[model samples]
Target: MRKIWLTGIAALAMASCTSKTSTPQPTASALAALPTTDWKSFRDTFIEDWFKVSPADAVYQGRHDFDGGLGDWSPAGLKRQGDFLRNAIAKAKTFDAAKLGKQDAFERDYLVTVAAGKLFWLEDADFPHRNPAWYVNAGLDPNVYIARKYADAPTRMRAMVSFLRKIPTAAAQIRANLKTPMPLSYVNFGVAAFNGFGDYYTGDAKKAFADVKSPALQEEFDKAAVAASKAMHDLGAWLEGQRGSATQDFALGADKFSRMIKETERVDVPLATLEAAGQADMKRNQLALVAACAQFAPGASVPACMAKMNANKPANNDPVAEARKQIPELRAFVLKSDVVTIPDQEQALVEESPPYNRQNSAYIDPPGPFEKGIPSVYYISPPDPSWSKVEQAGFIPGKSDLLFTSVHEVMPGHFLQFRHANASPSLFGRLFVGYAFAEGWAHYAEEMMWEAGLHAGDPETHIGQLSNALLRDCRYLSAIGLHAHGMTQEQSRKMFVEQCYQDEGNAKQQSARGTYDPAYLNYTMGKLMIRKLRTDWTATHGGRAGWKAFHDQFLSFGGPPIPLVRKAMLGGDGKAVF
Candidate 1:
């Protein structure tokens, strides 16, 4: 749902500045007159340095000064980024956490945590050379300029032209950086993403800017877009040519897998322990699904019960319209139930997914914290046209299922969370949200809404919520299985279908996704952590009366790793995450 590639590295920005001053030593009195360490100033300086290295991220955060800019993904540029992170990690560790104020110390720890995660991907994982999704997801998406109205048409058009003009070079750098003999799944994803970008750049992207009536600027745009499209097409073609040689060596293996979870999410549970947790959740959900089906589908098998639930598709086969109608209902329920605070009246617009970014079925593109008066967009991807009719039909979510999707992507989920995050006093917290924190909260919202009596006791509605939970549980296991235990792609796919009750099209898509995104396990992992935190905190705070207080306090941290938030809330390390 979020920019998976850049989130880790974006905030980890300082390349340690060394000095060569040879002045005389200060007297004790002069030393006493000097100011103490200012954590805020140091943190701000690091963020400013980060903007230069990851300008695309800055642009997303509504820093228009960086509009149309891209990160340097070339070999030297990547090395520079890695150096910056390593130095940032080293620099952050120099500060004595005990000396800093409570909030400052927390922020410092958050910075170190983020930098470590980034270093793992940039250096240890070697994602730039190994995974095409790294490039695809590394804040290269141009949807912001088109979707958000942060500027006049002419101004945004100029930014688009400048951005498009740089794509050819970026595309070449991406192609050169990616080493071949990639996993077949990665290669195919790369092919689809690049070619899809080519399609959008020439088609929808150009049209989005057509309203800009400057002939000179229009000419400039045409030239730039054409070049960008060609570069994208060429890159896609190159990846396609490597299809014959594609390997299945995508697994991170057990040790790296364990380290990945630890470094990225701050979760250090053993693989066996984590897998058992996931398996237990799946079984629990399966049992709940059966109980719901007994009332909803009578004697049908589990698959048949799910089939019956899915058959209640959106009217006229249009999910966008159905989603639009559900927004107010979901929003009202969140308020009525007092599950969480909706910080503002700002509503999310619903639309179909653009060609270039159909990786996830649904995702919310919220405006950055610095931007004002711009609405967030919730995008839903249609089935791939190449799929069979039945598969396409299966891809369309049922009305009940769509309700939870709305809950997850908007309403009291991501959009509401962002509203609180945007108000964060910390710039780093406002601008950068970790994957586990963001997705975990959203996934947790689905069940939270159900527990708060959304469509209370209705079998169909309960099925929708449980189905979503089952999907995440499968992801939790599949991620550990695929990356740590050498589970085959086919095995992962079967688990999605049989265990999660996902449709054929979704099962295949989800399994292939595990190859490039082993961290997709964060959804369920995050949810479990959050649930535990809520239970632990509310038990002492005010029992059920503290639900709203818990929700508000939880979202106020913006999006750090869950373990960090857990520690903050529980007043200790809160060692067990799952």
Candidate 2:
């Protein structure tokens, strides 16, 4: 699961220069002072400037100076964000590469790449107008105040009140910005998320901060919460009303989809080539699943075989409890296997997902790099109660399947990757983790754990890991097919069931997810690139013996696009990132 703070459209390196107007420009003096010796200070200032516009990001990064703030989401605000990125990109390109050292040059490229990625979404894609998820995930989230223990209860409560008070305006801005006749799946997502926020504000959010002892604050919180809840519910109702005109126009088309990969992930492979890679991986995982099924459930079909594994659901069907038990063992295994360095002893807590943010089955909410001693939270979402009992049951992961998920979200996956990221020397790298790099590493860790002898020779465990791989493979193809090849959601869902062997419920969820999250293909793409890099790097760096060193070095770059890391690692153009 992605971090709450980092999961939104606007969360990806929001802005570089602070811009008060729609068309911000670098000062002539600023541009004239080019190629200065203080690259580090410039980078640091960029981050500080970014926080002024994207305060929520700062709050999550453990910078309390911007604790109660949210990004401006009005039309003017959106234009300023885009303008800021454009100005920042221009300034970044002005620095002389020859004057900057190799590391500084690399950092310059990294910042430019980040700013470009953000620009693509803000200006090129026009997500703020076309996608409600941009607002829902970016501005509407209050998880930081509720979950992180960065401050005392009273302080956090105060921040929460400040946040809630702003939501009425944020809600209006979101409703105004989202043009109508949206994709059906997108409309539903917006409806559910907005309504969920309404429910959460008056329920869990209120309770979480109940211990704060101040009548004045309590009165303020109550008034703010009521308005916020009403605003959310009204927004949800408005989105639901859009169901009458909802269309199936969710595709980014081939061109923008193609650019999405290059700009955001730094991957320039042809879409057909990318599709072929996913298809080949799908076949590989399918064959492995067949062999594993033969061993685990003789004479049964693939679906039945998966059902058998999934039948052994978590104890009491409580994934949160099961996840807790799994993590300690997973941590111990990673240590014993010596696959990667843990960097620190910080542990992650397992929790049930909050109602407003249960879009993903599970995700790890790690503390930002600037934070210290704060535990990460691994949240597992229970099935929606509206579903039929069987569908709900199908939503719960089987014990073996949950184990690999544990491996993905905690242990040697997101949790450990973040621990290494927190130790990074480069602040830019620590702050601007690319989507593909983060998800890809977590997904790759699942397979790596299995290869490292996690439940070695156990067919069920192997099936568990392969289940996830096949799911990602299907996502890779589904994203391409849905967005670029004119595939319908039903077609994608059926493919998930028949080819990926997903349950009906999961297939539905995964298929719908592709429309909104086209770049989700990164799970497989990132894993493949990382695996290829490992083979090439380990060939000379002690082969299999270099696993820990490779992991440590790879993570040291924080979370740049994998290609950038590949170049840094292999010391060439790194054009062969595949």
lDDT of 2: 0.82
* Per-residue accuracy of model 1 over 1-578 as CA lDDT, tens digit each: 65443363222322111111111222223212211267776677667666666777766667776677787788777877777777777777778989987888888888887878888988878898999888777766788778878888777777877778779989989888888789999998999999999998889988998878799988988998999999999999999999999999999999999999888878888788888888888999999999999999999998999999999999999999999999999998988988788887899999998988887788888877767788889999999999999999999999999999999999788889888988776666786788888888999999999989999789999999998999999888999999989899999999999989999999999999999988899899889989989999999999989999999999999888888888989888746566
**Model 2, span 1-578: residue lDDT tens:** 67542232222232221111121222333333323347876676666566666676766666665666888888877876777677777888878978998888889888888878878877787889998777765657788778887767777787788788788988999999998899999998898899999989989989998888898988988998999999999999999999999999999999999998888778998888888889999999999999999999999999999999999998899999999999999999988999888887788999998887777789888777666567889999999888889989998999889999999899888888878776787766777777777788999999989988998779999999999999999999999999899999999999999999988888988999899888889889899899999999999999999989999899998888888889888988856356
Error of 2 at 426 (Å): 1.5
Residue 105, model 2: Cα distance from true site in angstroms = 1.1
Q: Where does candidate 2 have its weakest 10-residue lDDT segment?
A: 15-24
List candidate 2 segments past 4 Å from native. 4-37
Model 2 TM-score relative to the real fold: 0.95
